[model samples]
Target: MRGYWNWLFKGDRPGLYKFFDRWFVFHVLVGASLAMLLPLSLQATASSILLPLASVTVGLSFAWSGSAQVLLQSAEIEQLSSFRVGGIEEYVYTFQTAVLCVLITLVSWCVAGLGVFDLVWPKSSIPCVYGMVCFLLFFMSSVTVRECWHVVVGAQQLLLLRYKVRMDAEKKTNS
Candidate 1:
């Protein structure tokens, strides 16, 4: 438990990048497990109740993950100096990565709706079940969007810090 929490909120340190790389795998495994369960759980019940619960769970997961990401990025920038990697590029890369994820998910949802996933996903028992699956996809999609915003905001904060440091150094040099 201690190690899991540490991996989730890594501190500023030389090995922090390695920490993130390893924990990224852990997070995906957890997320994938949870995501798979939601669809199956929805299949067992009426969407009216299960859908809302799944939606809330998805939202909370995103918020929790996004906060964790912000904390990790903050610690990283503090330790490494965003100027070293060009904060703008980091920001753009983060944004692009997020956008790509969203587009892929959206396309997947559309394809599934058009029966593209029939070869894979089991057929929903009823129209409401289909609706429930769609809702779940949308809810999960919201998580992806928030995660991207998390990256953008995190990088922007680092960029501000980088600018302040540069200005301070200039003042000291001029003096």
Candidate 2:
């Protein structure tokens, strides 16, 4: 649990500073802005998009993990096998991303379920609490999106690597 948290935020880097990477900051800003400007209904968003999006991301992450394994075994990319992000191998990273997405989705669903309860809050604090919830939902959604993007980029890189390897092999055969 702590390991995953560290891997997600610190990568292979050391220090708390790594937690404030640009993408993290970007997600924070975007989520806060959205929460302030166009607060969304957490229940509605979770029920409609969050589950499906996380499902798709998980599937893609698995595929990417397989592709990464294939790439790792390729003789052409033998030297590239050492590539690591935050000290984690590419295949491990994909699997971790998938897990993270699912976890986020589950958390979102739990938050959404809270709406079923009729808990009363102080009138003065209602808006503040609601806004905080909204912010949290938006932040989690943004994190999921970021994970999806990472999987997509990994897939693209795998395709390009395969293409390059094929092209090189063809050139060798022709020569």
Candidate 3:
């Protein structure tokens, strides 16, 4: 926990965004690996459905875990204003993280679809309309989750700023 706190505050310097990108890349790799290696026979339905679902599960799990980490960092930000980290930086990072999550998720679906088709059809990679719709639903889900979290963080920051100003004004009038 202390390590996370230090990373969130002390590590907020410039050039860390590159590190964040790398970190997100690692998660995407995990999702892609899962999409490639998953055995379709394990699922009840056709391999096509099972493979993409499994890959999407893996991607969402990674995104949710990373989001939790960011939420924790945001809490630490609320507590440690003296750290000089700005909310805008946090918001920007959150947006970038969300975008990465969506991209990786889409890639995972693509890889899983290709893998499934390669196994079942052995020649064609083109999926039917149903397959395309399923993938679109998964991509939309990732986007929705990412956007919702950003809105939550932004709202929290606005409320905190408002409260701080109100308290400062009250103190001035009291004095």
Candidate 4:
């Protein structure tokens, strides 16, 4: 098991990234496991956690990438190669998404804290159970989204690599 894990994360590895990767895989498996452990109606409780956490992640990511100029500067592209979209567009998108996420979290957090879940189930500790469920769900989902992002960006990187390779081949042929 140790060897397997070491092989899986051969590099120093981004801890957060790794966490999300495993999280997504576990998230899928847990759905099947939940069916075994919980009634179908109870499964809806998972969303009580999922939405807020997802909101936090998007909010923080936007705050970091948009408002935090220092952080963005480090990774900022001089020129975008893939789409016409550039830094300005990214800045606007990030900030807007961040604001939206903040609004969502605020509303959801208030509802959850106000015992909205309890209103549904009524005095069976449903709120507490859903609260815990939401926490775990949000945690796993945030990481999962981060992990999947790598794949999406990696596909774009591959496209750029192919273009470079083709250009190099053409140059060689011409010479």
Candidate 5:
């Protein structure tokens, strides 16, 4: 866990794949390998265990991506752009985050309603529960996509800073 903490929080430098960990891929393989190690009778529970394990791995990937974005914003990148786009980006991002709150509410409501349904009518919601599980499974993966979106939007901040720096240098030289 300490190793994962470091991997997520500590970045060597900036790049496209800043926090990419091969262990994420390795984990899925490892889980598969571990399943093979188990006998057939216990195999039923193995699949259940693997999904939760993969979810943990997915959560970590999100942690790294989130940490990288936080680091980028907090870094000493000057905000002296002539055309400051930070405010606009933040507005859009804020709205997008608000939408995520709605999604959370919807997912929670569905899970709860389905839970009740399953309780009231045993086995009726078995397929529905499975479907919800699959939805949640991919929902975690969507963090990776959201991370990319954040990075792309955040890159504009860095670009504006770079432009300001270069233009300032040109002005001094010409003067």
Candidate 6:
């Protein structure tokens, strides 16, 4: 579990504070601002958007995972070795990013489910507590979005790498 967490946040990275990077800060700020300004109820948001979004993200993650596995198994390691990039580690990172995105989406979905069920807290009795819950859901949803972005970017990188490898292989054959 610890290794998975590290891979999710620090894949192929050399920093101890990788999880607290710029994107995380941006997500935090945006989430906080949205929580404060958006007057929408958590229940409504969860039932209307977050749940569907989570399902879509989970599907994407699974598809990305399969694609990564296929790419890694099919691509020639020797060809990748010639590239200046991190080689296998790049693909590993993409898989890790997709898995991380799925994890985030699942967690946010659970939180949103609680909101939908009014299981977080009694809204009328403890307004402050409900507010905090809303904030938490918003923050988690924002993080999930960030993770989804990372997964998409990773997918694009993998596609580019595959193209490069194929072109290089064709050049070698022609030569």
Writing each residue's lDDT as its tens digit, candidate 6 over 69-135 gives: 6766655643574574545655565467556656855666566665643564656777677777666
lDDT of 1 by residue, 25-48 (tens): 555554455455554433343333
Better of 2 and 5 by lDDT: 2
Ten-residue stretch with the least lDDT total in model 2: 116-125
- What does candidate 5's lDDT look like per residue over 1-175, in tens digits? 1233333344453122332455445434444454344333222433444455445434543444364345345423334322444333332343234334334534433443445433543333464454344334334334334444544455555556555667887899999
Candidate with top TM-score is 6
* Predicted model with the maximum lDDT: 6
Compare candidates 1 and 6 on lDDT and give the better one.
6
Clash total of candidate 1: 0
Write the residue-wise lDDT of candidate 2 on 69-136 in tens digits: 66656665554445534322434555565556657656665666465311443214587776676676
> Which 10-residue window of candidate 6 scores lowest in summed lDDT?
10-19
Winner of 1 and 2 under lDDT: 2
Q: What TM value does model 3 have? A: 0.34
Pairs in steric clash, model 3: none
Ranking by TM-score: 6, 2, 1, 3, 4, 5
Error of 4 at 72 (Å): 29
Candidate 1 whole-model C-alpha lDDT, 0 to 1? 0.48
How many backbone overlaps does candidate 4 show?
Answer: 2
TM-score (C-alpha) between model 5 and the true structure: 0.31
For candidate 2, list the clashing residue pairs, or say none. Answer: 11-86, 12-86
**Cα error, candidate 5, residue 110 (Å):** 20
- Which residue pairs come into collision in candidate 4? 20-143, 49-134
The TM-scores, one per candidate, come to 0.41, 0.63, 0.34, 0.33, 0.31, 0.68
**Superposition TM-score, candidate 6 onto the true structure:** 0.68
